[model samples]
Target: MDVVVIETRPLGDRSYLVHDGEVALVIDPQRDTDRVEAAAAEADVRITHVAETHLHNDYLTGGLILARAHGAEYLVSANDDVAFDRTPMADGGTVQVGRLTVKAVATPGHTHHHLSYVVSDGEDQAVFSGGSLLYGSVGRTDLVSDEDTEDLTRAQYSSVRRLAAEAQPDAALYPTHGFGSFCSSGPASSARSSTVAEQQESNHAFTDADEDHFVRELINNLTAYPSYYAHMAPANRQGPGPADLTVPESVDPAELSRRLADGEWVVDLRHRVAFASRHLQGSVSFEYGRGSSFTAYLGWVLPWNQKMTLVGSEEDIEKAIRDLSRIGIDSPDAALGTDPSALAPGTAVVHYPRVGWAEMLHGRSAGDVVLDVRRTDEYDAGHVAGAVNVPLHELLGRMAEVPAGTVWVHCATGYRSGVAASLLQRAGRQVVHVDAKYGPS
Candidate 1:
């Protein structure tokens, strides 16, 4: 038997193709199905099965697409309440493909229906432990409800313990999600496989810590999940197609400006710090960090009719667009160039100047609304007097909460403030971005 692991970068997702002679199986396919299909063709093996661990809240799965195209059996955890035409695999059930045995393990912590699979070539076993167990940590419970969350975490603990006790120490382990993945609660590792014994000794979620400690740590480490998660579940339930996964072409700054003026949303895909420092006025700073949650967040914040433009390095344009598309926000004309000076008309360029205490006081007296777009934690650690707290990440979604009309935006250095300014300006508000590239001290 041969197993191949495919890494989907940026999203930090992984899919696998396991083959035994002329038979093949695919696990947790990403949005792009062409590559998986091509690989199967090259191997001259018939795709016998396409399996999903659970209903993902991140990217749309390609399991149905691959199944329909190849006449492969579509398998999912039996506990998934969402209706789909496929063979639901129960816990401990095994499916045979030539000499390979794919055993389903019910491990429901990340979601109520989540499952992990163990594969064997009649002898040695390799577990495709989906979201249940990752490199350093386990899947998060907040992906579902509080009860489900605790239940899944507890189940995950048992699942890992069982694998440690039953599976061989040298049995290869493969997971669906990794580092930079929103589904994972801990940092991902570069090392592909670790023995059951090694995980028993080293994996934090599996060793030394009690259940209560593990649950507390898991909940605390989970960052804000994207708002788009509310939409993803239903879309996956409906079994949507993967045809609309295309990136937007780069647009001139001037054209981008016109779109913003016409009520289009300008999304600056820079880091929060980069956006606050200097950016076009009225542009919302929706920084894309690791994982599928970014797409979910965009869906929650951005409307369908809103024309969108991306402000980032040229390399980031394609990725930004792809991330947006996963949640059904297909704004092909939203991409903008990276140069700050070339920003389209109506774009508010951020400027942060270093000045003395007296100069800072004078500027505030001159009537600039001292806009503070950092998180609550950053805001409490001493900020400009009279500045209002509006985190850059939540600015786009909470537009009504921001004071209308004209304002001066600033963050610690002005990176995120720039992004905030661009987003606000595109939203049809007037803004003057303060260039705080240098500290007041």
Candidate 2:
């Protein structure tokens, strides 16, 4: 069997397409099915099956629709109560793709009903460890609820031990969520691939540590999941439709005023630098591009009750709607992708100011605030000495907490800071963005 990894960057989640020249199996696909179809076309194999590890909470799954389009069987755990039609993959259940065999191994830890599939071409073997096991760690058990976390952590430990004992010693491990994905609890081992034997020797999951200690470490180390995560489970339970890729109706600048007055969302989708130069006064600046962290941050920042209108290039607007749909921001009510010169009278085109970190430090004052917009945990780990920790997601509600006068907004990298600076400027603060890029230092 040939296994190809489809990695979505920025978030770094992965999907896999395993084929044997004649038939293929797609595992944990994203909402955009074009890439998967293109890969299948290039491989010259008909897609025969699509399988999901569990009901995804991070993003919408394209498996059911992909299966229907290709007349392939869609697989989900028998223990899962799916809203739509699917073939239940009971533990030890087997499916065939041409000459290759795919067997489901029940591993319920990532969710209440997660599965790890072991594939074989009679002699050679590979394990599609969907979230149960990873290179150096396993899936986070706390995403479900506080009450279920410890039980799930123990289940994860037992499930991984089962895989190590049963799967081929040299079987390749292909996990769905360890490449810097928030679903994972620790850093990835190596970028490419590792075998069962290798993971056994080095992976702490296989060590002789006590289960209680492992659970303590896992819970203590899990970083904050975005508030947008709350919307994913219910959205997936209802089953999201295929993403709508059409450009929305372009409302007049006059209508935009009325919407803004009515508390609608007018998201500005330009680069941070472009948005900093000039933008519509009441609009929220959320930079959009090919590989931006737009979906997560936009979902985190945009008010759920407000009607939204996306502003960007036609190409970007199309892709934006698709990406947004994955996180249940299905339809933007309207759109406008033209020069801002025609904006309604006195719309007040605003500007965001910037300064380097060195300049910000050198010219610092008691009242000039250094606002850090990263997550609280990130801020706690190590931030610029006295920077205030107001994560960009919470900035809308916590604007009062920022000290009066000139505010200096920054994040670990500059992406989130750009967003924070825009919000502050829109709120009538004299803000200066810390423009230099830095990681966790």
Candidate 3:
């Protein structure tokens, strides 16, 4: 059997294309289908099947689209009551394509309906454990709900143990959430694949802890996930629309003004310093090439799948649109390369003051508030005393919670805080960005 690993580095999700001589299958594919199709073409095999372990919350899946396009069967956990058509799979369910034998194993930990697929050629096999038994740690159970966290975590322990015992120590372990994915209970061991024997020896969750200890460690370790996650499962359940890679039309000043008036987000994709110098009156700073990939970790703060206009250098529009498409954000209404002053003529523009951490500490008075825009867990780990904990993802709706006077914004590093500082300035707050060391030092 030929197993091709497709890593969507932007979102830290790994998909797999398993093929034999004449037929192939895809597992846990993200919205992007180009790579999957390419692998199949290279192997000279037709894609015969696509399987999803569960309703994905981290990003949209392309299973339905791939299945429709290829005239292949689509497989999903029978437990999920999705609206669309699919071959419902249960534990012990089996399917065959060419020489490959596929079997589904029920692993209810990440979600209530999660299933792990094992594809074997005679005695040799690999497990497509999507968000279940990960490389160094297990999947985060709390993504569904706080109440389900402990129960699912307990179930996870049993599930992993069962998988290791049944697959034997030698079977290859391939998981969907790895690399730098936030869905893992802890960090991945490496970007590479591992064997069940290797995980049994090295992984903390797999080898070291009991069920009670595992639950505590997992719950305590989970930080704030993306706000956009709440919408992903439902979107995937309904069956997502096809990939929209259309380069948006250039909007005139009047259209830009109308969209801004109608509550569309005008995101500035330049560096923070450039944005702070001068930008559209209400535009928010969201640089495309910041600390992380723009679409992967930080882009979830906005509405998923909704089209938003881009404001930045003319050269950046194409790359920005491609980045947004990875997470199912395809409707990039327009990209404006001109200066904000030129794009939104007669509209009021704004700017904010950027200060180093030391300057902020020495210069600001008690009346000036320090706003930490990192994750809640990051703030909890250690933060400057009296810093308001409003994560960048939750900032737009919680402006009232920020103090009235000067709001000094910061993140562990500077990228997130830069975005937050721009937002505060756009909201008419007196903003000071502590763009230097502000974490525990």
Candidate 4:
């Protein structure tokens, strides 16, 4: 038997391909299905089954696509209760691919229908635990209902314990997610797979911690989930309908401005601090730092047909595009410094060292209304006095709230404020962006 683990790095998602001589089975495939197909072809085996441990809230599962392309059976947990066109798997039920026997194990803490699969090669067994367990952490229970939190957490505890006790101490452990993923806490390293003996001694949730403490730590450290989750749950439940997996050509900034003027959405894909410092005035700011959930949130909050532009450093372009594609938002145009057409015929743009006492006072008296697009918390922490707070995330929704005519917007740095200025100009509002020293230019 041969087992290959495919790691979608920078994203920290893991998928597995298990094969014997004639048939193969894939577990938790990523959105890119070509690689899986190539691997199967290279090994001279037919893919017989595609399995999803749970409905994912991060990236769209490639199970349906892989199943259709290869004419394989798509298996998901029967307990999931979501409508999907696949064979429903129950605990103890088994599927076979050559010498491999795959058994479903219900592990529902991350979600009500979550399943962990136990793979046996006649003599040895390995568990594809999914989100139920990771190297240093367990799957978060808050992705689902509060009513199921306790039940799911309890179920997870037992499931991990069962795997630790029953599966061979040497059986390899493979999970769908690792560190840097919102699904699990801690670093994703080769340490992800451990022997039962190692887990018994080092896994916190498995040993030193109780259910209540486990739940408390998870909930307390939980960052704000991407707003897209609410939508992704239902979308995944129904199965991600057909989508073209091609990356679109990069777009020009001027064209992006035209789209925004026509009421299309513009997204600033920078970090929170960069976005807060300065951004396209009316553009929506969604940080990728939050996780792949950024795509999901944009899907729910922004209109599907809305044209979009990306504003960030060159390094972020590929990731920004990939994340957007995960949620079905593709083909975003790249942003340039300023949209020339959006600017007035001769509107002057100014640069500043910082929104210091002197800069703010001078800019304000010079008919520039200082705009603070940072979050409420940031604004309260001593911003240039009198600057109005309209966080970048809320900018588009609150366009009417900002006073019209000759506005000077600034964030902690100049990058986001510049993004904000471009957005305002696209909206046909007169504005000059202040590239303060403290912010990105």
- In model 2, where do residues sit more than 4 Å from their true spots? 333-338, 342-346, 438-441
Q: What is the lDDT of residue 320 in candidate 3?
A: 73
Candidate 1 stretches with Cα past 4 Å from truth are 42-44, 186-192, 246-258, 267-305, 309-320, 334-389, 397-418, 424-441
TM-score, per-candidate, Cα-based:
0.77, 0.93, 0.91, 0.71
> After aligning candidate 1 to the native by TM-score, how far in Å is the CA of 91 from where it should be?
0.2
List model 4 lDDT by residue over 290-342, tens digit each. 33345544554455556677666555666667656665565676663333224
- Which one is best on TM-score? 2
| lDDT, candidate 3, at 96 | 96
State which candidate, 1 or 3, has the greater TM-score.
3
Candidate 4 TM-score, true structure as reference: 0.71
Tens digits of lDDT, candidate 2, 267-366: 8887878878787777777888755688878877767645788887777777788778777677786556645546544577778777776777787777
TM-score of 3: 0.91
Angstrom error of the Cα, residue 427, model 2: value is 2.6
- What C-alpha lDDT do the candidate models reach, one value each? 0.70, 0.81, 0.82, 0.68
Tens digit of per-residue lDDT, candidate 1, span 76-173: 87767656698889888889977898888777777777778888897788878778778877777787775566667677777777656656777777
Off by over 4 Å in 3: 261-263, 290-293, 296-299, 303-307, 313-316, 322-330
- Of the two candidates 3 and 4, the one with more favorable TM-score, higher being better, is 3
**Ordering by TM-score:** 2, 3, 1, 4
